[model samples]
Target: MVWEYEVRYQCLRERDKAYTNWLNRIPHKQYALAFDGGYRWGHMTTNLVECINSVLKGARNLSITALVKLHASQLASGNIQVSCFDRQNEVFKVREMPSGLEFAVDLRGLRCDCVEFQVDRIPYRHVFACCASQQLDWQVYVHDVYKMDQVRQVYRARFRSLGNPTTWPAYNGPWFVPNSYLTRVTKGRPKMTRLLNEMDTRMLRRPRHCRLCGVEGHSHNRCRQSAGANADRDAQ
Candidate 1:
């Protein structure tokens, strides 16, 4: 998809060099997915539903703590291997045992080539291995949003409840509602605002077909094989 974006960008640049030049003036990391380090989750041009769908498409249905625990367990298994580079930067190359696949880990930037570390805002197995190799603290890379202290801080605020509607201040703002007369008397559930993506498309059943003749255009009632069956039924 990033390659698709790149192809579109190149087309736009070729169509109008001036516009592309202006676009290049802005920081790529601020407006480009290719440079965002998987932080934006490709929501720049998406609607609310699309944005939420895009973000959760790759996320597991587990809680942050549960995912963290799972990753920690993988690290504790000692199946992953890490090799720190000699450069001044805190970059390490990690390889998973019995898999031979390697991932580049940048401790200084708090990111891994696998993107699990940066995207989740938590240290995954690769990050855990990198930290162990460097003797650094993996907790330092975790975002405060996933911490218990932040959750407790949210409840510290005093939210005094408004007693009842009768004692409340008189409302002066104009009220509006849908015109009931214009509403449709539909039979099924109302359609959602979301545009059906590939995932939704996969769940849909195929088009109707003629079971009697094994043809798609018409059903069994209209099929040529149905005539013989109808004649037999009439005699019966």
Candidate 2:
């Protein structure tokens, strides 16, 4: 049953420490939906999947037809194969077709043995069948998060562009120099052990300016004018 994300993680950690340790190397925000902080807005994968969809637009109809056929088959399964037994008015024992596996659905609690209800907080065919048999309002089981007002707000504001890089202000930020000693051999032909990358050897940042004169080439302490000024001030 769709356990809480953190609960599931804790269980995994307890079950296998090695797997969890391997997982710990990667950032949580990159992999876990719970840690994403609503950035995806229910979109699991955007760019890569969207790129694939755009490339496969011509052959998309075949997949669509297959999905429709699968949906129709599932619809039949809901209607003919599934039967529910009510326990008072809150709990239900649903017996499936063929396999005859039983699932307990708690109406008041908004939970089902099949995790579809708990994950999306939306009623699926099983929950609908259960509600239908009892003549209970299934809409009451729907979470408020799915309301039109909330859904509309997700796309209400348009995304603004970052604008031209040329128009951007001169960066006075700290330079992040990569440690040559720490760098492992990446993709490329390996050379002499003594040789490092030419790019790494060079200072890739803007030239330093003197603090006193704000002129490039030398630091404030080393500036001739700054030293002369200090000497003159000392003589005075």
Per-model TM-score, in order, reads 0.34, 0.34
The 10 consecutive residues of candidate 2 with the worst lDDT sum are 192-201
Whole-model lDDT, model 1? 0.77
The C-alpha RMSD of each candidate to the native structure, in angstroms, is 24.4, 25.1
Candidate 2 TM-score to native? 0.34
lDDT of 2: 0.72
Off by over 4 Å in 2: 1-89, 155-161, 167-236
Native-to-model Cα distance after best TM-score fit, residue 205 in candidate 2, in Å: 68
The candidate scoring highest on lDDT is 1
**Residue pairs in clash, model 1:** none
lDDT of 2 by residue, 1-236 (tens): 11466787788899999878998899887877657786863354544455555544445556778767755665555552334455566787777654567788887888888887899999887788787887888899989898998899989999988899999899999999999999897876666322222222244467899988889988888899888999999999
Question: Model 2: clashing residue pairs?
Answer: none
